[model samples]
Target: MTGRRVRVAVTGMGVKCPAGNDPEDVFRRVLHARPTAAVVPGLAEAGLPVRFACTVPEFDLAPYIGRREARQIDRATALLLCAADDAVAGAGGAVRGPGHRAGVHIGTGIGGLPGMEEVVYGHGERPMGMPVHTVPKSMANSPACRLAMRYGLRGSCMTYATACASGTNAIGEAARRIRDGELDVALTGGVDAAVTKVIVSGFARMRALSVRNEAPELASRPFDADRDGFVMGEGAAVLVLERWDLARRRGARIYGEVAGYATTCDGAHAVAPDPQGAMAAECMRLAIADARLTPAGIGHINAHGTSTVLNDLAEAVAVERCFGPQSPPVTAVKGVTGHLIGGSGAVEALVALLCAARGVVPPVATTASTPDVGALDVVLGAPRQVARRPVLSNSFGFGGQNACLVLRPAP
Candidate 1:
């Protein structure tokens, strides 16, 4: 299967987000420029420092998930399961092929924190006082394994843990497998339910949190001059990537084609983005080249805008250096969704794919006006309708991990 142009295409997608628990709903909300992040319920009463999060409100996954399965799988994994179910459903149920031809690749920032905390409280300092489900729930790959097992996917199954880039890494890796003929189809995404106090306190300790108790909904202001650190978010997004030939053979609807992917390491700082943005620029360059296209061909960019001061600044520099002046339309969804961390990239994938398919660029639902920092056509205030071309989705994570993927409307 090596060097054999496997023709990767996006067949389906599902998302559980503040705007909506379903992809259509999320698309509609984003298209209309709605804000979802708010003061998380119960956080104020708990006396926590940070107050806002992009919480999934009134999500009844029971309608989509089984009861027995719901009881054991961690909420993080459960979120992935629910999203994967939606994607597979969008693909018209399962593929009519060998189960081994399908695969699962999941990413999670902090897997099973809810269940692990439960175990810690339920069992004290005694040795080996872990529940049977503890190990499975705590494993970062638990969602990937469970998705593969449930779907009977025997093809390559794996998970990535590259912090914020985890989900993007999973999606990129899945596309790689499809491109290499390792699998005909794959379900890949990222999930996180790690809005725990520990996670919050840790970020707060680093002073990387938006202390906007007054206006929680307006806390996440990506690319805004007055932006603070990112607000934590929770949810999951899954996508079905199928070989274009197989999708055509099955008469499947294609959302977009994954044209290229690139992943790189900064090797500079463990927690901070490079001031020069060299690694980030190189990453985008590599992805654009991998797609066999020049940066001039890209029409839109779904940036890894986490709302942090350094991140937005560095990312803007990278995009400018890579695309030059009069760059593509860029919209940073984290302004509205907050920073979902690991799941951010996959959710951004949903936005980018839709941009490529529908020929419309969603607006940046920011609290304040977007800063005029770079040479980008930053979409704001209103959605833009234009001919959608290749869209680049960027993801940069902790430990200086950078990834970019180019997707185009499936022809």
Candidate 2:
């Protein structure tokens, strides 16, 4: 098993985001370049610097979980659970096997932030009184633990907290385990519910949020010359990964193959990306190499375009460095969904897979300004049709954490 490399198949995916809940619906919304960012009901009244966000609209837990059980869990955990249920069901029920052969890997930048805020500020009559379930609900690993318990998976249950790269790292690590024969099945993705007052205000203080309060839809303009910053978003995405052979044997509907993955760090700045994007380019090259393919094989890139000035520029530079001036067309989904933080990578990965399978790339929403970063072919205005080929998805985080995954259309 040391030198062996087994393919990992993405059999099922579920998403709950600002665009929609169902994966297809969300994909369609993005394909049409419909922006979801809008002013939160009370944010302006709260006097926050940023008043707009892309939030999961009208989510009810009663349909996905028992009412009593939902009461004990945080919104983040509940979101993950709902997505997990959909993913498993989409995978033709659970992957029936020994419990130890399965695992749960979930990622989140800040877990249960709303729940923690409630505990700190008191809920209803309880003034600063901690609830018994507060600890479990607020824990970063709660999503993974709860998923494992719900599905009876006894293998490793892990959570990644690498800022925005958390989801990509979790999915990449789970694929590595399966490729190394350590696990047969894994539930891997990311979720974050950080739309609380504290989280929003914190990012606002950092000046990381877009202030296009008058027109929230146009706020997240990735790679656009007028791009200022990102808009905070909340959502969850889960994917069911299984060994390629096992998936074929079980007759699962494979969406795509997780062909390669690589992660790297810049070690340069805590919040700013390296202007040259040297390490980011290296991460992409490494992932391509891991997939046993060259840069020429990549069809397009699903950029980790956070809509921030530095991030979009750095990513543009990285693309140029990785694939040269004639790089494949690039698209950023953050313009449609805003920045989902930890969940952005997983959701964008799903979009990449969809692009590969459907033979088209969605337009980067609401970006009217010319790209300031050289001659990169940024997809805009309308979806671009292309040959079905492997797609490279990127996720870069605040602490210089960068992760890349290459997904190929199902054979």
Candidate 3:
């Protein structure tokens, strides 16, 4: 424990994205610059503040999920479990045997909100009676439990709800557990299907959602001066993480190594990031240090670019402050995936892994010009192939919950 260097290998992967459900299809779609977001069916007629979202369409859940379990679980957990199958299967089915060797650390920002909102907002329903499976299913831990039960992972099954940072934190914590010798493999990622009527209205009230109703696909313009706010999006991403040695021993397909993880707090603002973004920079620095590297080692970054003005700027500033003018290629996925809220980081972390593995930088879409573009290498227009290896990924939440992860191509 004292001397052995810990390396977290991402062996399996799956994506339940708007463009596609299958991981392979989604990855190809992203590479080809396909659109995944559109106006949801029959929602615009209801006059919801946000009319469009990145939704998986023409898809039957039963084919990928069991009808009995799907009925009891929220869509968030359902998608997570579906994605988990591909992930563990990618891990070479080593999740078998004593469940204690495996764990589930899935993250979600809004747990059962659509279902919970239905029960609570239904004025016709009785005031006191709880839904048959309200508490357990609506709890944030539900996704973790459902994932664990679905995959027989009995160890460290839990959930983290750090707003948009939730998924990344869960994955980071899972990496820690494996590094600390608590588990050998983990199903790590995030899911959120909470883009509901009430949730959209809430964001509209706060003006945190893009009002590009007529131009839904062109919304979520991160780092652009004209960027208003992030468009709400929903999806699930899953990655099977294992100790590098174990993955190599099993001859599993490796995506990347979870080389470093660092989380910090500003404690300066309730919701807004510190304008200086010093603490955020430190998080990146600390992550690099944990990976036993320096700022110059990073070849790319997957930013927590929510398409919101402040967030994009703050993140850009933080990266520059941390890595100086030599900041590597920076890319924002929110523009394409929309903002998955709690699931943002974990899903984007996968984008980072892909960037390092495939040596292609994902382009930030619908973006115009950033004031600090000179400092940040914002990948745009097209996917750029670079000699990328270790990349930094960031996710900052409302309560100052910020987690940075350094991932590198599999050695």
Candidate 4:
């Protein structure tokens, strides 16, 4: 419907992750390569194979929402609500009124897993006293619906559930809608609170989770030669995207521009990525092209590095295929925050924007061993200074879902 798409500006961001709640604090922790993985409070007694995870520490919803309202929602919804509150506030409360065409788009892998596990598996035969709001809270669209209701966003309220790529896809889709002039403002991000016994045990049984119980903080070594598997992490991240002109008119503090976005499917496997990473490479190239940029234009890459042997190798190959021997410097936030599953992409997107604005790249905290893929320059140990340019953030998920976003520094 257009020749050149409208630019979407990122005006506000909020994060509730293992690293921290504030965006700046989280980025600082990531820059320093601080690891937050630790043993879950009750996992050891629960007898699960994997006992550790990167959990949001001491999160309380009372400050953001009333106690009565918080009681009806699940942990995932609570996290999203908290992040959304911060994001909306940070955006100077511009999208709240009924006059604006606002929307809510959220991504989540398994929404309300804790509630589902409790009501479904916890109650054996004691006449399960399910709460009235259990069904609503346990639904996969709970977070998105709750956010929309809270903000009074009247436009399309949608939810994406592409396993781990949920958050990135949500942000990309929302940006597209705004760029296409379908919406004036949007709250888009990813959130997941699935560090439950069922999820952890399932991953452990599949040999997809790290088994380093003694030293959980050092367990998630993405792209490292000695890396075994990813450690589960739970968190939420939300960003406020607005039409560039609207943001400028309002004098909003622009963090960056969502220049281009692309989503692709491997169509090769249900759980494992194609070792060749052909589709993944194509996705990256498509996103860069959509942004009117070339491979050489991208300054850095925030890899979808899950610490799993298969994912890291596949992603590395994809990067090499996309940019050849001159691949951009790469960093994996999973090393510090662990694998946030659906929320990882959104948080990493924020990190990429910060990197571009600050002219530096953070390190992959635990990746000390030689990188399995020697062709790529994986940032490690210390932050690397670089010129501000477009940053490519990647998110690949189960069932071969891949999403990429090209974020350009604000002019």
Candidate 5:
């Protein structure tokens, strides 16, 4: 175990998503085909183009964080802290390891834009004075710093800003460190609170946001013919990754094992995916190879189906090429959660683990049929029961960032 690649165990997970607050609740919503997309409160008043968003409900932050500290941080950072706290609680109240050997890595594409907006425009009729703590709250790396300082983690810490792939890459990189014996444990995931007016308007200008202002719930229809674009969403998810041997020795409840991870850049486009999806296909191939599992061994794939036509189609092509005609059953959580930006990948990874744990593949949660070019067995209508096997979760972001993770049932 000292010299070889150490097995990494997912000892704990915490989530604050539109689907639900905890992992089991989220899974139940997915299995029962509940959708969370709806109109965002402030966007319509601001005259934004796309008003709907998958917003996290009023989760009790007081239980996990102090009131004064909460006010000083942005919503995105607060979500990260809460998720981390839940991860520890999920791991039987504490992460077992020396503080010096544990690390934290959280991903966020943009931080505190909503807070910045509030400072400039105020929450009322009058513009408010800028808060002195604005810089700390808005920094992309704030979550990572807060986690480290609060948890007394002395190991490597980082915050990835790879657009939408940030969370996937963060978890993947943390797994790498544990597998490489650089650290014994790591808390890694993604967080983003991008449901602000300015953010939505900006994406609207790029034609990247869904404009089904009339029907909020139907806006994020991934892989559907009627799908226009993704709905904005805000949420966070964090996982505690421990070296498998250490987890076993401590008798920790093992949720699953991160067996493989691989990331690649499209290098072809800034705002769009490679029309051919060659790089994405290769990214999946490499992840499977890294897991030492054949493509056929993968039981399910949690797709990065943004519901945007171009992305869903490109990802489908990549899936077909990598898994061939007999591709695994695929599902997209974005149908329910919309696009969580950096948080999308991490939260979807959690869904992947839940699939393995429950021995079922959650349905697509969208009413539309899969497009012909991207036609694969997309689980829809109802959840499909299946034997637990390695699950592959994909995250593709703007600027061509692609990440894939292979999660295996705890052996």
Candidate 6:
């Protein structure tokens, strides 16, 4: 790991998403474009205009950690801990080799809004008397702090909160550190458990939520004619990253290599992407160049198709501009997973790695008729078997934050 072209291997991945609880299950659902959005419990009675969201069902944290321990942490932290456990276990156990050389990186857009809401609203009347663990639970750095404590990682424990781009930035930064020889291993990803009424009400008030209460499953139809808005989702995804040479020496099961990562900002809008997509396309170009590969080397794209008109269209224009008319096959996992906000990028990166491992492209879950945004190839109906090549995943967040990563099959 000497030059800027140092390779970072994705040895293992662990994901808890709306599509499924495990990586394999999630990939299967992704390939077929299965919809997972459903009415959130109590959302209908809560009087919020938006009623549906993609919620993880009854995640049992018992096997991963004790009940008492789970009670102390936030739901976002709990999800990250579970995903990290799976990731570490998949990579052949805990940090037995040079814990000081390892690190933790996680991203969350809203941190522990669910916990804060419960503490504030559940036990009313006493606004001043909050729980002692409130700050610990609600802070954005809790996941990273808890992960570092859990695995004894002493190097660079950090958290990025760039809205939906948080996860992508976390993974990118981790890969960059390892590539630059700052660390040998990093447990990096993102998580968000912000499906609370406080969170839901805010989005609903902004009118950014879908009002398809009767048809929750069809609410998140990205790149579709009838698409209204994105469906909020909750989940976590963590990837085990190591130096490519080290991974090979250890005989770790390498899924793919984090070949390149780049981030840019539109600097034009607070919540909407640039209609021209110049900045987004430039970000993609920079990521491709960082990988030391041309755009022709890419075989597929995991897009940030959040089902919203602004995001979907802007992303489409960007993809088309970057790769020209014959763009690589593109798929939006959000149609099924909904928009996981901070967790979306890591999960999409996992999807890209899985595609490289399996050589199959997933479909854009809910779009029966593709929107007339651009001519880029949008995988639909069913999964496409591809001749394994490099894949690029994109994530754009509010405040004009944009991040892109290029992933190549492990050599």
Error of 3 at 78 (Å): 0.7
Q: Write the per-residue lDDT of candidate 6 for residues 279-357, one digit (tens) a residue.
A: 9999999999989889999989999989888888899899988999888998888999888989999999999888976
In model 3, where do residues sit more than 4 Å from their true spots?
A: 127-130, 372-374
Model 3: per-residue Cα lDDT over 160-191, one tens digit each: 88888888898899999999989998888988
Which of the two, 3 or 5, has more lDDT? Answer: 5
Which candidate would rank higher by TM-score, 1 or 4? Answer: 4
Clashing pairs in 5: none
Residue 46 displacement in candidate 4 (angstroms): 1.2
Candidate 4 TM-score versus the reference: 0.97
Clashing pairs in 2: none
Candidate 1, residue 408: the lDDT equals 86
lDDT of each: 0.83, 0.90, 0.81, 0.90, 0.87, 0.87
Tens digits of per-residue lDDT, candidate 1, 126-195, equal 6387766678877778889998888788988898888888888889999999888788889999988777
Encode model 4's per-residue lDDT on 154-226: one tens digit a residue: 8989999999999999999999999887899999999998888888888899899999898998899889998
Cα RMSD, model 5? 2.2
How many backbone collisions does model 4 have?
0
Query: Model 2 off-target regions past 4 Å?
Result: 1-4, 123-128
Q: What TM-score do all the candidates reach, one by one?
A: 0.95, 0.97, 0.95, 0.97, 0.96, 0.97
TM-score: which is higher, 1 or 2?
2
